[model samples]
Target: MSFQSLQLAPELDQALATLQFSVPTPIQQQSIPLVLEGHDLLATAQTGTGKTAAFMLPILHRLLKEPEHNGKVRALVLAPTRELAQQVAANSEAYAQYTGLKVACIYGGANISPQEKALKAGVDVVVATPGRLLDHLLKGTLKLDKVSHLVFDEADRMLDMGFIGEIKRIMRHLPEQRQTLLFSATLDEQVQKLAAQWLAKPQRVGVDPENSAAEKVEQLFYAVDDDRKRELMSHLIGKNNWQQVLIFTRTKNMADEYAKELNKDGLPTLAIHGDKSQGARDKALAQFKSGKTRVLVATDVAARGIDIVDLNYVINAQLPFVAEDYIHRIGRTGRAGKAGMALSLVSIDEQWLLEELEVLLDERLTPQWLQGYEPDLTKVPKDNRKNSAKARKQRDKKHILGKRDQRRRKK
Candidate 1:
């Protein structure tokens, strides 16, 4: 359905039209109306499902219709990472262009003076990371008394990053009577507890199954030696002529090292991790998005919240410890109804991680063996001392292959 059918303000309609947003995404169609009605909501949706706009459009409408209050933060959106906060702020600005909504993003990294000045000027909407936002609130620089809407975008991610305490602190400061909306890809036990505590009879909305990956993404895995994984990655990128590839590593050191190796192969590559300054991270993201950089290697934690819609490929150089992270890693591509591909380089040592990932996605990844780099089929996969029943259950439930020795011995 068209965005105009939502009965948005005239200015919001004009902004949507000028932005070429002809149709509303499914999440938007369901969420915009509820948010505009000022109800607390808990929305579970997968990544790349236009979840960002689900909250942005309604918040913009609310800010525009209400009269301006001086030096008061009317709307607050808390994201888990700096990149997510900036992305949310950018989307908020794009949709609120015609509404004269003053939106600003505050996060750690770079100078805080500018964010301080913006907060002092009375922003209608403020998107922020929890740590930095708490810093401002503690310093008595940001006033949230007037905030009628509070959003925890990526609530699951915040819990993963160990931000529960900070989020609780922020909740204490917010007015007791206000609308709270929580959006996440998955609502695990911890997330459910938070929702129970924060939301008051939240309207439940589910667009996609929890922890589901985008259907447009074609997933594959390559079985290779640990040392030869980079070679395979270089060959895959060059062989397929894949541009705008996002390569994920489990550690910061690996991200930096792999980027260098890919660069040596004549592929324009850069790395983003916690070690790099915010400026470097931003520059790397810009280059990757503009197609100037063909490959971007990043640690899973650092790249967790990146929002780049035109990414053509995703390569998991190393799998994450948490199976859920595998979903978000490949989600960088195949966004907004665009088809994309994800290639994961796996070695015998990483077999357990691969197994865990498969369990989360509920499907076995097809392993494409390269001609020259065939894996040693004789090597026994690592079971890591002893296998627990929980791990085996995860494997059986998801139909993950391999680890026959452990399963056979258990029987």
Candidate 2:
């Protein structure tokens, strides 16, 4: 359906037409109306499904209709990561371009002075990460009593990142009388509980099934030895002449090491992770988006907000420990109805992960053996005593005890 049919304001209509957005996505079509009617909403949607615009457009419309009361914050959107926060802020700005509405993006890894200045300038909307937003609240740089529309974009990711406490703290500052929207890719038990607590007679919208991958993406699995997986990646990239690829690694060190080794072999690769400064991460992403970098190796958290249109390939250098994350990784590609490829290199040790993913996906995933990198089927996966779950728990206990002792000595 046409966006104009949604009864949006003239300003929003102009913005959509200027951006060449004539038709509303399914999620947008279902969500925009409920939000405009002042109903709390619990929406189940995936990335690249136009979910941002689903909530942003209606909020912008509502903000335009209601006169600002003392120029206080009228809307607040909380994202899981700084990158996702930036993405949502960008989209909000573009949507509010014609309406003269101001948006402030607050997050960590940068100077807080600038964010403080923006809040002092009086913004109509604030998009932020949970931790940094709390910092602003504690510093009295931001207030939320006037917030009429509250959004928890990617609620599942925020919970996965362990922001439950921060979210609860931030909620204590908001007015109970407001419109709330909770969007999640997966409506797991935790997400449902959050909805039950926050929403009041909400409209439930599910655009896609849970744990479902994009329909346009072609999924391929290859069995390669753990050590030879990198070689196989290089071979496939060169043989397929892939122009730009986003590869996901399991850890920060692995991302850095993969980029290093790939660049040493003349592949223009870059790595992005939490360890890098904000400026460095932005630069790497800009380079990759501009086609200057051939490949970008990243951890799951680091790759949260990457939205590359027409991105053809995504390589999972290593399978993720959590099966649901595989959906998030591949969702980066095959966006906006474009065809994409998700290639997973599974080693003998990681072969078990495939079973978990298959079970969640409700489909049997077929794996093919690469000619030269075939693994020994008879060999049992090696177990490292140091990396065992029990060992990790022990280390965590000792670390906590050490910190407690240090604090006691200081006191």
Candidate 3:
């Protein structure tokens, strides 16, 4: 159904029309009505599913309809990363353009003076990261006592990054009675616990099944030797002439080293991780988006909230230890109903990790070996080691039972 049937305000309807958002995504369609009705919501939807608009539209409508000009934060959005927080703020500004609302984004890895000034000058909506928001709170530069709407975007990622304590602390500063909305890619145990603790009688909405990857993405893996991964990646990218590639590495050093190696091979790449300054990260992202950089090498932390339009390729130079992160990484591609490709370079050491991912996805990923770059399978697999341990335990158990039987016979 169209957004008009969702009972949005006239201004919001006009904004949607101007922005060419005539149709509503499934999450938006299910969530907008409940949010407009003032119900607490816990929503699970895949990345790149228009979740930002799902909550932003309803909140902007409420603000415009009620017209709160109290010079205090009326809406507080907590995002896990600076990029996501900035994106949320940008979307809020775009949707509220006609409605005359003030939106500000606050996050770490940047100067706080400007954020302090913006808070002091007054803003209706504050999109912030937990650490930076806490800094503002401690400095008495921001107030949430008048907050009527609270949103936790990417709740799972926030918890994964160890922001539970910060989230709880931030919650203590909000009003006792308010509308709470939580949006996550997966409703794992931690997300469920957060919902139970914070959301009051929430309305649940899920667009896709839990932990399911995008249907349009072609998921493939190549088994290569650890030292030959970079070679295989370069071969695939060069042979396919793939542009706008996003590669994920497990560590900052690996990301940097791989980016350098790719650039040396004439790939024109840039790396982004925690070690990079905010300015550097933003510049790298800008370059990539502008097509100035062919590849972006990133760690999981730096890759969060990356919404590159028409990003067609995502290479897993190194698989994540956590299975859920694999979903998020590949999600960078196959957005907005576009076909994309997700390729993973798996080595012998990561076989167990791949197995764990397969269990999570409920499907086995058959590995394809590249010519001249095949993995050496001479070493014992981790599964075999586990099996040997299990055998030893079984033998000990039999011995103990035999001795007990002998004692019983003597008795």
**Highest TM-score among the candidates is held by which one?**
1
List CA RMSD, all candidates. 4.0, 6.8, 7.7
Lowest lDDT sum, 10 consecutive residues, model 2, at 399-408
Candidate number with the higher TM-score (1 or 3): 1
- Candidate 3: C-alpha lDDT: 0.87
TM-score to native of every candidate shown = 0.94, 0.92, 0.92
| TM-score-better candidate, 1 vs 2 | 1
lDDT accuracy of residue 69 in candidate 1: 82
Tens-digit lDDT string for candidate 3 (1-411): 989898888888888888899899889999999999999999998888899999999998898777575778899999999989988899888898887788999999999999999888889999999999999999999989989999999998898888989998999999989999999987777788899999999999998888778888999999988888898889999999999999999999999999989998999999999999999999999999999999999999898888976999999999887767898999899887788999999888777667656655767677898888878889655544553343344344432111212222333
lDDT (10s digit) by residue, model 2, range 87-161:
999988998899999999999999999999999989999999999999999999999999999999989888878
Q: How high is the CA lDDT of each candidate model?
A: 0.84, 0.87, 0.87
* lDDT (tens digit, per residue) of candidate 1 on 315-407: 988877676777788888888889889888888877766666666667666677889999988887666534334564776876433332234
Off-target runs (Cα >4 Å) in candidate 3 are 67-69, 379-411
Worst 10 residues of 1 by lDDT: 399-408
